[model samples]
Target: MRIFDPHIHMTSRTTDDYAAMAAHGVRALVEPAFWLGQPRTSVGSFVDYFDSLVGWEPFRASQFGIRHHCTIALNPKEANDPRCREVLDILPRYLAKDGVVAVGEVGYDSMTPEEDDVFAAQLELAERFELPVLVHTPHRDKAKGTTRTLEVVRESGLDPSMVVVDHLNELTVGEVADSGCWRGFSIYPDTKMDPDRMVAILTEYGTERVLVNSAADWGKSDPLRTYATGQAMLAAGFSADDVDQVLWRNPVAFYGQSGRLELEGADADEGATFEGNSILRGARAS
Candidate 1:
Protein backbone atom coordinates (compact mmCIF):
# COMPACT_ATOMS: atom_id res chain seq x y z
CA MET A 1 0.00 0.00 0.00
CA ARG A 2 2.32 2.73 -1.23
CA ILE A 3 0.85 6.16 -0.42
CA PHE A 4 1.61 9.59 -1.76
CA ASP A 5 0.71 12.65 0.27
CA PRO A 6 -0.06 15.22 -2.41
CA HIS A 7 0.07 18.09 0.05
CA ILE A 8 2.00 18.65 3.28
CA HIS A 9 4.34 21.24 4.90
CA MET A 10 7.48 19.30 5.70
CA THR A 11 9.60 22.38 6.34
CA SER A 12 7.99 22.96 9.71
CA ARG A 13 8.00 19.25 10.53
CA THR A 14 10.75 17.21 12.18
CA THR A 15 12.67 14.14 11.03
CA ASP A 16 10.70 11.98 13.47
CA ASP A 17 7.51 12.97 11.69
CA TYR A 18 8.95 11.81 8.36
CA ALA A 19 10.07 8.50 9.87
CA ALA A 20 6.56 7.78 11.14
CA MET A 21 4.97 8.73 7.81
CA ALA A 22 7.38 6.58 5.81
CA ALA A 23 6.94 3.66 8.18
CA HIS A 24 3.23 3.90 7.52
CA GLY A 25 3.70 3.83 3.71
CA VAL A 26 3.99 7.48 2.69
CA ARG A 27 6.40 6.79 -0.16
CA ALA A 28 6.25 10.30 -1.55
CA LEU A 29 4.93 13.76 -0.65
CA VAL A 30 4.31 17.06 -2.43
CA GLU A 31 4.68 20.23 -0.33
CA PRO A 32 3.35 23.65 -1.19
CA ALA A 33 4.89 26.99 -0.18
CA PHE A 34 2.44 28.44 2.29
CA TRP A 35 2.13 31.15 4.93
CA LEU A 36 4.57 30.29 7.67
CA GLY A 37 2.97 30.26 11.10
CA GLN A 38 4.77 33.57 11.67
CA PRO A 39 4.80 36.29 9.05
CA ARG A 40 8.10 36.56 7.15
CA THR A 41 9.36 40.14 7.23
CA SER A 42 11.32 40.32 4.02
CA VAL A 43 11.87 39.02 0.47
CA GLY A 44 15.10 37.42 1.72
CA SER A 45 13.01 35.30 4.04
CA PHE A 46 10.97 34.06 1.11
CA VAL A 47 14.10 33.31 -0.90
CA ASP A 48 15.40 31.28 2.00
CA TYR A 49 12.02 29.58 2.32
CA PHE A 50 12.04 28.65 -1.36
CA ASP A 51 15.58 27.37 -1.01
CA SER A 52 14.47 25.05 1.78
CA LEU A 53 11.58 23.72 -0.26
CA VAL A 54 13.89 22.50 -3.01
CA GLY A 55 16.96 21.80 -0.95
CA TRP A 56 16.80 21.14 2.78
CA GLU A 57 13.30 19.67 3.03
CA PRO A 58 13.80 17.08 0.33
CA PHE A 59 17.02 15.96 1.97
CA ARG A 60 15.24 15.65 5.28
CA ALA A 61 12.56 13.44 3.72
CA SER A 62 15.17 11.22 2.10
CA GLN A 63 16.59 10.42 5.52
CA PHE A 64 13.35 8.54 6.04
CA GLY A 65 13.33 7.15 2.49
CA ILE A 66 10.46 9.25 1.15
CA ARG A 67 10.43 11.07 -2.17
CA HIS A 68 9.63 14.77 -1.73
CA HIS A 69 8.35 17.27 -4.24
CA CYS A 70 6.87 20.77 -3.91
CA THR A 71 4.50 23.35 -5.32
CA ILE A 72 5.77 26.95 -5.53
CA ALA A 73 3.57 29.96 -4.74
CA LEU A 74 2.88 33.05 -2.67
CA ASN A 75 0.35 31.91 -0.12
CA PRO A 76 -2.88 33.85 -0.48
CA LYS A 77 -2.77 35.06 3.12
CA GLU A 78 0.49 36.85 2.47
CA ALA A 79 -0.55 38.20 -0.91
CA ASN A 80 -1.85 41.39 0.62
CA ASP A 81 1.49 42.50 1.96
CA PRO A 82 3.11 44.96 -0.45
CA ARG A 83 6.53 43.86 0.74
CA CYS A 84 5.67 40.25 0.03
CA ARG A 85 4.95 41.18 -3.56
CA GLU A 86 8.66 41.58 -4.02
CA VAL A 87 9.08 37.90 -3.30
CA LEU A 88 6.20 37.07 -5.61
CA ASP A 89 7.97 38.72 -8.52
CA ILE A 90 10.87 36.28 -8.30
CA LEU A 91 8.70 33.15 -8.00
CA PRO A 92 8.90 32.58 -11.74
CA ARG A 93 12.57 31.68 -11.57
CA TYR A 94 11.91 28.99 -8.98
CA LEU A 95 8.69 27.63 -10.44
CA ALA A 96 10.70 26.04 -13.25
CA LYS A 97 13.32 24.70 -10.92
CA ASP A 98 13.74 21.03 -10.15
CA GLY A 99 11.24 19.45 -7.76
CA VAL A 100 8.41 22.00 -8.20
CA VAL A 101 5.40 20.10 -9.51
CA ALA A 102 2.70 22.79 -9.48
CA VAL A 103 2.13 26.48 -8.90
CA GLY A 104 -0.02 26.21 -5.89
CA GLU A 105 -1.66 26.45 -2.51
CA VAL A 106 -2.47 29.87 -3.93
CA GLY A 107 -5.96 31.29 -3.97
CA TYR A 108 -8.33 33.28 -1.75
CA ASP A 109 -7.82 33.97 1.90
CA SER A 110 -10.20 36.52 3.41
CA MET A 111 -10.97 37.28 -0.25
CA THR A 112 -8.86 40.44 -0.21
CA PRO A 113 -7.75 42.52 -3.18
CA GLU A 114 -4.14 41.52 -2.64
CA GLU A 115 -5.10 37.89 -2.77
CA ASP A 116 -6.84 38.60 -6.05
CA ASP A 117 -3.84 40.31 -7.58
CA VAL A 118 -1.38 37.64 -6.51
CA PHE A 119 -3.69 34.80 -7.44
CA ALA A 120 -4.25 36.24 -10.89
CA ALA A 121 -0.55 36.79 -11.41
CA GLN A 122 0.37 33.27 -10.39
CA LEU A 123 -2.29 31.82 -12.65
CA GLU A 124 -0.67 33.70 -15.51
CA LEU A 125 2.69 32.32 -14.49
CA ALA A 126 1.23 28.83 -14.48
CA GLU A 127 -0.05 29.45 -17.95
CA ARG A 128 3.32 30.68 -19.12
CA PHE A 129 5.11 27.66 -17.70
CA GLU A 130 2.38 25.30 -18.83
CA LEU A 131 2.24 24.00 -15.28
CA PRO A 132 -0.69 22.83 -13.21
CA VAL A 133 -2.07 24.76 -10.23
CA LEU A 134 -3.20 23.76 -6.76
CA VAL A 135 -5.68 26.33 -5.43
CA HIS A 136 -6.51 26.90 -1.77
CA THR A 137 -10.01 28.07 -0.99
CA PRO A 138 -10.63 30.44 1.91
CA HIS A 139 -11.32 28.97 5.31
CA ARG A 140 -14.03 31.56 5.84
CA ASP A 141 -16.55 32.67 3.21
CA LYS A 142 -15.58 29.43 1.48
CA ALA A 143 -18.47 29.16 -0.88
CA LYS A 144 -17.66 32.55 -2.34
CA GLY A 145 -13.95 31.84 -2.36
CA THR A 146 -14.42 28.57 -4.21
CA THR A 147 -16.68 30.28 -6.72
CA ARG A 148 -14.25 33.10 -7.33
CA THR A 149 -11.40 30.62 -7.62
CA LEU A 150 -13.28 28.79 -10.33
CA GLU A 151 -13.98 32.03 -12.15
CA VAL A 152 -10.38 33.15 -11.94
CA VAL A 153 -9.12 29.76 -13.13
CA ARG A 154 -11.47 29.86 -16.06
CA GLU A 155 -10.36 33.36 -16.92
CA SER A 156 -6.78 32.22 -16.86
CA GLY A 157 -7.66 29.77 -19.64
CA LEU A 158 -5.75 26.97 -17.95
CA ASP A 159 -7.08 23.59 -18.89
CA PRO A 160 -9.48 22.59 -16.14
CA SER A 161 -7.69 19.26 -15.88
CA MET A 162 -4.59 21.08 -14.69
CA VAL A 163 -6.25 22.71 -11.69
CA VAL A 164 -6.81 21.27 -8.22
CA VAL A 165 -9.08 23.25 -5.86
CA ASP A 166 -8.28 22.21 -2.29
CA HIS A 167 -9.75 22.32 1.25
CA LEU A 168 -13.32 21.69 0.17
CA ASN A 169 -16.09 21.11 2.69
CA GLU A 170 -19.59 19.76 2.00
CA LEU A 171 -20.82 23.08 0.66
CA THR A 172 -18.16 23.47 -2.01
CA VAL A 173 -17.46 19.85 -2.99
CA GLY A 174 -20.14 19.58 -5.63
CA GLU A 175 -19.34 22.95 -7.13
CA VAL A 176 -15.61 22.28 -7.17
CA ALA A 177 -15.99 18.87 -8.79
CA ASP A 178 -18.60 20.20 -11.17
CA SER A 179 -16.21 22.93 -12.24
CA GLY A 180 -14.19 20.30 -14.14
CA CYS A 181 -11.17 20.47 -11.82
CA TRP A 182 -9.63 18.13 -9.30
CA ARG A 183 -11.17 18.45 -5.83
CA GLY A 184 -9.20 18.11 -2.58
CA PHE A 185 -10.32 17.69 1.01
CA SER A 186 -8.05 18.36 3.95
CA ILE A 187 -8.56 16.10 6.97
CA TYR A 188 -7.35 18.28 9.79
CA PRO A 189 -7.79 18.26 13.54
CA ASP A 190 -10.72 20.34 14.87
CA THR A 191 -10.96 22.98 12.18
CA LYS A 192 -11.06 21.36 8.72
CA MET A 193 -13.03 18.33 7.55
CA ASP A 194 -13.11 15.29 9.80
CA PRO A 195 -11.94 11.82 8.77
CA ASP A 196 -15.39 10.36 9.34
CA ARG A 197 -16.88 13.12 7.23
CA MET A 198 -14.27 12.54 4.55
CA VAL A 199 -15.34 8.90 4.45
CA ALA A 200 -18.95 9.98 4.10
CA ILE A 201 -18.01 12.28 1.22
CA LEU A 202 -16.25 9.39 -0.52
CA THR A 203 -19.31 7.18 -0.01
CA GLU A 204 -21.53 9.86 -1.50
CA TYR A 205 -19.32 11.04 -4.36
CA GLY A 206 -17.41 7.81 -5.10
CA THR A 207 -13.99 9.47 -5.47
CA GLU A 208 -12.91 10.42 -8.98
CA ARG A 209 -10.53 13.29 -9.46
CA VAL A 210 -10.35 13.95 -5.75
CA LEU A 211 -7.36 14.32 -3.33
CA VAL A 212 -6.89 14.33 0.45
CA ASN A 213 -4.06 15.95 2.40
CA SER A 214 -3.20 16.74 6.02
CA ALA A 215 -2.37 20.38 5.25
CA ALA A 216 -0.20 19.92 8.32
CA ASP A 217 2.15 22.67 9.26
CA TRP A 218 3.16 24.78 12.28
CA GLY A 219 -0.26 24.42 13.85
CA LYS A 220 -2.47 21.92 15.58
CA SER A 221 -2.40 19.15 12.96
CA ASP A 222 -2.07 15.40 12.82
CA PRO A 223 1.09 14.48 10.96
CA LEU A 224 -0.16 11.00 10.10
CA ARG A 225 -3.46 12.16 8.66
CA THR A 226 -3.13 10.44 5.27
CA TYR A 227 -2.44 7.14 6.99
CA ALA A 228 -5.27 7.62 9.46
CA THR A 229 -7.66 8.52 6.68
CA GLY A 230 -6.79 5.26 4.91
CA GLN A 231 -7.41 3.33 8.10
CA ALA A 232 -10.82 4.97 8.41
CA MET A 233 -11.68 3.92 4.85
CA LEU A 234 -10.65 0.36 5.55
CA ALA A 235 -12.75 0.26 8.70
CA ALA A 236 -15.66 1.48 6.62
CA GLY A 237 -15.32 -1.60 4.31
CA PHE A 238 -13.49 0.12 1.47
CA SER A 239 -11.29 -2.22 -0.55
CA ALA A 240 -7.51 -1.75 -0.62
CA ASP A 241 -7.96 -0.45 -4.17
CA ASP A 242 -10.31 2.24 -2.97
CA VAL A 243 -7.87 3.52 -0.36
CA ASP A 244 -5.00 3.33 -2.83
CA GLN A 245 -6.75 5.49 -5.38
CA VAL A 246 -7.64 8.21 -2.90
CA LEU A 247 -4.35 8.42 -1.04
CA TRP A 248 -1.87 7.15 -3.60
CA ARG A 249 -2.91 6.95 -7.22
CA ASN A 250 -4.81 10.22 -7.38
CA PRO A 251 -1.93 12.33 -6.07
CA VAL A 252 0.66 10.46 -8.08
CA ALA A 253 -1.34 11.02 -11.24
CA PHE A 254 -1.49 14.70 -10.36
CA TYR A 255 2.16 15.30 -9.41
CA GLY A 256 3.69 12.90 -11.89
CA GLN A 257 2.12 14.96 -14.65
CA SER A 258 4.84 17.54 -13.96
CA GLY A 259 7.57 14.94 -14.62
CA ARG A 260 9.55 16.19 -11.61
CA LEU A 261 8.99 13.59 -8.90
CA GLU A 262 11.10 10.47 -9.43
CA LEU A 263 11.76 7.31 -7.52
CA GLU A 264 15.40 6.42 -6.94
CA GLY A 265 16.54 3.00 -5.86
CA ALA A 266 15.43 2.34 -2.31
CA ASP A 267 19.12 2.22 -1.38
CA ALA A 268 20.13 5.38 -3.25
CA ASP A 269 21.12 8.39 -1.20
CA GLU A 270 18.61 11.21 -1.76
CA GLY A 271 20.06 13.56 0.86
CA ALA A 272 20.71 17.24 -0.02
CA THR A 273 23.82 19.26 0.68
CA PHE A 274 24.36 22.95 1.44
CA GLU A 275 27.37 25.10 0.50
CA GLY A 276 29.62 26.13 3.35
CA ASN A 277 29.00 29.69 4.65
CA SER A 278 25.47 29.50 3.16
CA ILE A 279 22.46 30.77 5.12
CA LEU A 280 20.86 27.33 4.60
CA ARG A 281 21.59 24.76 7.28
CA GLY A 282 20.12 21.34 7.90
CA ALA A 283 20.78 17.64 7.16
CA ARG A 284 23.72 17.27 4.79
CA ALA A 285 23.42 15.38 1.51
CA SER A 286 25.03 11.93 1.87
Candidate 2:
Protein backbone atom coordinates (compact mmCIF):
# COMPACT_ATOMS: atom_id res chain seq x y z
CA MET A 1 0.00 0.00 0.00
CA ARG A 2 1.47 3.36 -0.96
CA ILE A 3 1.54 5.84 1.95
CA PHE A 4 1.94 9.52 2.55
CA ASP A 5 2.66 10.40 6.17
CA PRO A 6 1.04 13.83 6.48
CA HIS A 7 2.90 14.80 9.64
CA ILE A 8 6.21 13.28 10.81
CA HIS A 9 9.43 14.63 12.27
CA MET A 10 12.05 12.96 10.07
CA THR A 11 14.85 15.14 11.47
CA SER A 12 14.80 13.16 14.72
CA ARG A 13 14.88 9.86 12.82
CA THR A 14 17.82 8.08 11.18
CA THR A 15 18.71 7.11 7.62
CA ASP A 16 17.57 3.56 8.39
CA ASP A 17 14.10 4.89 9.22
CA TYR A 18 13.93 6.48 5.77
CA ALA A 19 14.98 3.19 4.16
CA ALA A 20 12.31 1.35 6.13
CA MET A 21 9.63 3.93 5.21
CA ALA A 22 10.56 3.76 1.52
CA ALA A 23 10.41 -0.04 1.61
CA HIS A 24 6.95 0.21 3.19
CA GLY A 25 5.63 2.44 0.35
CA VAL A 26 5.98 5.94 1.85
CA ARG A 27 6.55 7.79 -1.40
CA ALA A 28 6.22 11.24 0.22
CA LEU A 29 5.82 12.80 3.68
CA VAL A 30 5.55 16.16 5.41
CA GLU A 31 7.92 17.00 8.26
CA PRO A 32 6.35 19.82 10.25
CA ALA A 33 8.39 22.15 12.45
CA PHE A 34 7.61 21.06 15.96
CA TRP A 35 9.10 21.32 19.42
CA LEU A 36 12.21 19.17 19.72
CA GLY A 37 12.70 17.05 22.86
CA GLN A 38 14.36 19.94 24.68
CA PRO A 39 13.36 23.58 24.58
CA ARG A 40 15.29 25.63 22.07
CA THR A 41 17.10 28.64 23.61
CA SER A 42 16.74 31.22 20.88
CA VAL A 43 15.33 32.26 17.53
CA GLY A 44 18.66 31.32 15.97
CA SER A 45 18.08 27.72 17.03
CA PHE A 46 14.69 27.75 15.31
CA VAL A 47 16.27 29.23 12.20
CA ASP A 48 18.79 26.39 12.08
CA TYR A 49 16.06 23.83 12.65
CA PHE A 50 13.87 25.28 9.92
CA ASP A 51 16.85 25.38 7.61
CA SER A 52 17.52 21.71 8.17
CA LEU A 53 13.84 20.92 7.61
CA VAL A 54 13.99 22.42 4.13
CA GLY A 55 17.64 21.82 3.27
CA TRP A 56 19.16 18.71 4.84
CA GLU A 57 15.93 16.74 5.48
CA PRO A 58 14.75 16.83 1.85
CA PHE A 59 18.18 15.72 0.65
CA ARG A 60 18.14 12.92 3.24
CA ALA A 61 14.67 11.68 2.19
CA SER A 62 15.56 11.77 -1.51
CA GLN A 63 18.42 9.34 -0.85
CA PHE A 64 15.78 6.71 0.06
CA GLY A 65 13.42 7.79 -2.78
CA ILE A 66 10.84 9.47 -0.50
CA ARG A 67 9.83 12.99 -1.49
CA HIS A 68 10.18 15.30 1.54
CA HIS A 69 8.19 18.43 2.23
CA CYS A 70 7.64 20.56 5.36
CA THR A 71 5.42 23.09 7.08
CA ILE A 72 6.85 26.25 8.73
CA ALA A 73 5.47 27.72 11.94
CA LEU A 74 6.22 28.67 15.52
CA ASN A 75 4.86 25.55 17.21
CA PRO A 76 2.44 26.20 20.08
CA LYS A 77 4.67 24.86 22.85
CA GLU A 78 7.50 27.26 22.06
CA ALA A 79 5.02 30.02 21.41
CA ASN A 80 4.79 30.42 25.17
CA ASP A 81 8.38 31.55 25.35
CA PRO A 82 9.04 35.22 24.72
CA ARG A 83 12.40 34.47 23.18
CA CYS A 84 10.97 31.97 20.75
CA ARG A 85 8.26 34.44 19.70
CA GLU A 86 10.81 36.09 17.44
CA VAL A 87 10.92 32.89 15.41
CA LEU A 88 7.61 34.02 13.98
CA ASP A 89 9.33 36.93 12.25
CA ILE A 90 11.41 34.58 10.18
CA LEU A 91 8.72 32.02 9.43
CA PRO A 92 7.62 33.46 6.11
CA ARG A 93 11.14 33.15 4.71
CA TYR A 94 11.05 29.40 5.30
CA LEU A 95 7.38 29.16 4.34
CA ALA A 96 8.21 30.60 0.92
CA LYS A 97 10.66 27.78 0.17
CA ASP A 98 9.58 25.20 -2.40
CA GLY A 99 9.79 22.42 0.17
CA VAL A 100 7.33 24.06 2.54
CA VAL A 101 3.80 22.80 1.89
CA ALA A 102 1.89 24.30 4.81
CA VAL A 103 1.97 26.27 8.05
CA GLY A 104 1.69 23.78 10.80
CA GLU A 105 1.98 21.96 14.02
CA VAL A 106 0.28 25.21 15.00
CA GLY A 107 -2.36 25.15 17.70
CA TYR A 108 -2.75 25.17 21.46
CA ASP A 109 -0.16 23.38 23.57
CA SER A 110 -1.39 24.64 26.95
CA MET A 111 -4.42 26.60 25.78
CA THR A 112 -2.65 29.66 27.07
CA PRO A 113 -3.26 33.24 25.94
CA GLU A 114 0.11 33.26 24.22
CA GLU A 115 -0.68 30.09 22.26
CA ASP A 116 -3.90 31.71 21.13
CA ASP A 117 -2.10 34.79 19.89
CA VAL A 118 0.59 32.81 18.12
CA PHE A 119 -1.90 30.44 16.59
CA ALA A 120 -3.92 33.35 15.26
CA ALA A 121 -0.82 34.99 13.81
CA GLN A 122 0.20 31.83 12.02
CA LEU A 123 -3.26 31.52 10.57
CA GLU A 124 -2.73 34.96 9.14
CA LEU A 125 0.50 33.69 7.65
CA ALA A 126 -1.35 30.74 6.16
CA GLU A 127 -3.91 33.12 4.72
CA ARG A 128 -1.25 35.42 3.28
CA PHE A 129 0.60 32.54 1.69
CA GLU A 130 -2.58 30.76 0.63
CA LEU A 131 -1.31 27.57 2.29
CA PRO A 132 -3.07 24.84 4.18
CA VAL A 133 -2.73 24.48 7.97
CA LEU A 134 -1.80 21.34 9.84
CA VAL A 135 -3.06 22.10 13.33
CA HIS A 136 -1.80 20.24 16.38
CA THR A 137 -4.62 19.85 18.84
CA PRO A 138 -3.72 19.73 22.53
CA HIS A 139 -3.07 16.32 24.01
CA ARG A 140 -4.91 17.30 27.19
CA ASP A 141 -8.49 18.51 27.43
CA LYS A 142 -8.86 17.76 23.76
CA ALA A 143 -12.61 18.16 23.77
CA LYS A 144 -12.25 21.66 25.16
CA GLY A 145 -9.15 22.46 23.10
CA THR A 146 -10.64 21.17 19.87
CA THR A 147 -13.76 23.19 20.50
CA ARG A 148 -11.61 26.26 20.93
CA THR A 149 -9.58 25.30 17.86
CA LEU A 150 -12.63 25.31 15.66
CA GLU A 151 -13.79 28.51 17.25
CA VAL A 152 -10.49 30.22 16.51
CA VAL A 153 -10.41 28.97 12.93
CA ARG A 154 -13.94 30.20 12.35
CA GLU A 155 -13.10 33.49 14.03
CA SER A 156 -10.05 33.87 11.82
CA GLY A 157 -12.36 33.34 8.87
CA LEU A 158 -10.03 30.74 7.41
CA ASP A 159 -11.90 28.08 5.54
CA PRO A 160 -12.25 25.02 7.72
CA SER A 161 -11.46 22.92 4.66
CA MET A 162 -7.98 24.51 4.60
CA VAL A 163 -7.34 23.39 8.18
CA VAL A 164 -6.53 19.87 9.37
CA VAL A 165 -7.31 19.05 13.00
CA ASP A 166 -4.62 16.50 13.83
CA HIS A 167 -4.01 14.03 16.65
CA LEU A 168 -7.72 13.33 16.81
CA ASN A 169 -9.45 10.29 18.26
CA GLU A 170 -13.01 8.93 18.35
CA LEU A 171 -14.21 11.63 20.72
CA THR A 172 -12.82 14.50 18.64
CA VAL A 173 -13.28 13.22 15.10
CA GLY A 174 -17.00 13.81 15.04
CA GLU A 175 -16.58 17.47 15.95
CA VAL A 176 -13.97 18.12 13.28
CA ALA A 177 -16.03 16.19 10.79
CA ASP A 178 -19.00 18.40 11.55
CA SER A 179 -16.88 21.53 11.51
CA GLY A 180 -16.03 21.09 7.81
CA CYS A 181 -12.33 20.68 8.64
CA TRP A 182 -10.34 17.68 7.54
CA ARG A 183 -9.61 14.93 10.10
CA GLY A 184 -6.13 13.66 10.98
CA PHE A 185 -5.15 10.74 13.19
CA SER A 186 -1.65 10.14 14.45
CA ILE A 187 -0.94 6.41 14.81
CA TYR A 188 1.68 6.07 17.47
CA PRO A 189 3.17 3.19 19.51
CA ASP A 190 1.26 4.29 22.63
CA THR A 191 -0.34 7.41 24.09
CA LYS A 192 -2.10 8.06 20.76
CA MET A 193 -4.61 6.26 18.57
CA ASP A 194 -3.74 2.70 17.58
CA PRO A 195 -3.98 1.18 14.11
CA ASP A 196 -7.01 -0.93 15.01
CA ARG A 197 -8.79 2.13 16.33
CA MET A 198 -7.75 4.10 13.26
CA VAL A 199 -9.21 1.40 11.03
CA ALA A 200 -12.38 1.50 13.12
CA ILE A 201 -12.54 5.24 12.63
CA LEU A 202 -12.18 4.92 8.87
CA THR A 203 -14.92 2.32 8.87
CA GLU A 204 -17.27 4.70 10.61
CA TYR A 205 -16.16 7.93 8.95
CA GLY A 206 -16.08 6.56 5.37
CA THR A 207 -12.69 8.10 4.51
CA GLU A 208 -13.90 11.37 3.01
CA ARG A 209 -11.50 13.84 4.67
CA VAL A 210 -9.35 11.62 6.88
CA LEU A 211 -5.55 11.86 7.03
CA VAL A 212 -3.50 9.24 8.89
CA ASN A 213 0.10 9.79 9.90
CA SER A 214 2.72 8.16 12.09
CA ALA A 215 3.77 11.47 13.68
CA ALA A 216 7.07 9.74 14.49
CA ASP A 217 9.17 12.09 16.49
CA TRP A 218 11.92 12.18 19.13
CA GLY A 219 9.61 10.31 21.49
CA LYS A 220 9.07 6.56 21.42
CA SER A 221 7.23 6.34 18.07
CA ASP A 222 7.17 4.38 14.85
CA PRO A 223 7.62 6.02 11.45
CA LEU A 224 6.07 2.90 9.88
CA ARG A 225 2.88 3.35 11.87
CA THR A 226 1.12 4.76 8.78
CA TYR A 227 1.97 1.72 6.71
CA ALA A 228 0.92 -0.49 9.59
CA THR A 229 -2.45 1.28 9.67
CA GLY A 230 -2.90 0.45 5.98
CA GLN A 231 -2.13 -3.19 6.77
CA ALA A 232 -4.64 -3.16 9.60
CA MET A 233 -7.25 -1.63 7.30
CA LEU A 234 -6.72 -4.45 4.81
CA ALA A 235 -7.02 -7.01 7.60
CA ALA A 236 -10.33 -5.40 8.52
CA GLY A 237 -11.55 -5.96 4.93
CA PHE A 238 -10.84 -2.46 3.74
CA SER A 239 -9.93 -2.58 0.04
CA ALA A 240 -6.50 -1.50 -1.24
CA ASP A 241 -8.21 1.57 -2.68
CA ASP A 242 -9.59 2.38 0.75
CA VAL A 243 -6.11 2.13 2.25
CA ASP A 244 -4.73 4.32 -0.55
CA GLN A 245 -7.43 6.91 0.00
CA VAL A 246 -6.72 7.38 3.71
CA LEU A 247 -2.95 6.92 3.66
CA TRP A 248 -2.01 8.47 0.32
CA ARG A 249 -4.64 10.27 -1.72
CA ASN A 250 -6.16 12.14 1.20
CA PRO A 251 -2.82 13.70 2.13
CA VAL A 252 -2.06 14.48 -1.51
CA ALA A 253 -5.39 16.29 -1.70
CA PHE A 254 -4.73 18.26 1.50
CA TYR A 255 -1.16 19.38 0.89
CA GLY A 256 -1.67 19.65 -2.82
CA GLN A 257 -3.86 22.67 -1.97
CA SER A 258 -0.57 24.54 -1.63
CA GLY A 259 0.18 23.97 -5.31
CA ARG A 260 3.69 23.16 -4.12
CA LEU A 261 3.40 19.44 -3.43
CA GLU A 262 5.95 17.81 -5.74
CA LEU A 263 6.59 14.11 -5.40
CA GLU A 264 10.10 13.68 -6.72
CA GLY A 265 9.85 12.36 -10.27
CA ALA A 266 12.63 11.32 -12.66
CA ASP A 267 15.62 13.47 -11.86
CA ALA A 268 17.58 14.97 -14.68
CA ASP A 269 20.46 15.33 -12.25
CA GLU A 270 20.07 12.27 -10.06
CA GLY A 271 23.37 13.11 -8.49
CA ALA A 272 22.17 16.51 -7.21
CA THR A 273 23.35 17.51 -3.75
CA PHE A 274 22.47 20.20 -1.18
CA GLU A 275 24.83 23.06 -1.97
CA GLY A 276 28.16 21.21 -2.32
CA ASN A 277 27.29 18.50 0.22
CA SER A 278 26.42 15.13 -1.22
CA ILE A 279 24.33 12.30 0.23
CA LEU A 280 26.62 10.09 -1.87
CA ARG A 281 30.07 9.44 -0.48
CA GLY A 282 32.01 9.70 -3.74
CA ALA A 283 29.53 11.06 -6.30
CA ARG A 284 29.30 14.75 -7.34
CA ALA A 285 26.23 16.85 -8.23
CA SER A 286 27.48 17.05 -11.82
Question: What 10-residue stretch in candidate 1 is worst by lDDT?
Answer: 277-286
**Model 2 per-residue lDDT at 193:** 98
Worst 10 residues of 2 by lDDT: 277-286
Error of 2 at 152 (Å): 0.2
Clashes of each: 1, 0
lDDT value, candidate 1, whole model = 0.83
**Which candidate tops lDDT?**
2
Q: What are the per-residue Cα lDDT tens digits for candidate 2 across 1-286?
A: 5678999999999998987787666778999999998999899999999999989999999888788999999999999999999998998888888989999989998999999999999999999999999999998999999999999999999988899999999999999999999999999998789999998888898889999999999999999899788888989999877887888889999999999989645121323443443233321121
Displacement of the residue 275 alpha carbon in candidate 2, Å = 26
For model 1, residues 42-81, the per-residue Cα lDDT tens digits are 8999999999999999989977768888999999988888
In angstroms, the error of model 1 at 26 is 0.6
RMSD of each: 7.0, 6.2
- Evaluate all candidate structures by whole-model CA lDDT and list the values in order: 0.83, 0.88
Q: RMSD (Cα, Å) of candidate 1?
A: 7.0
Could you tell me how far off, in angstroms, the CA of residue 13 lies in candidate 1 after the best superposition? Answer: 1.0
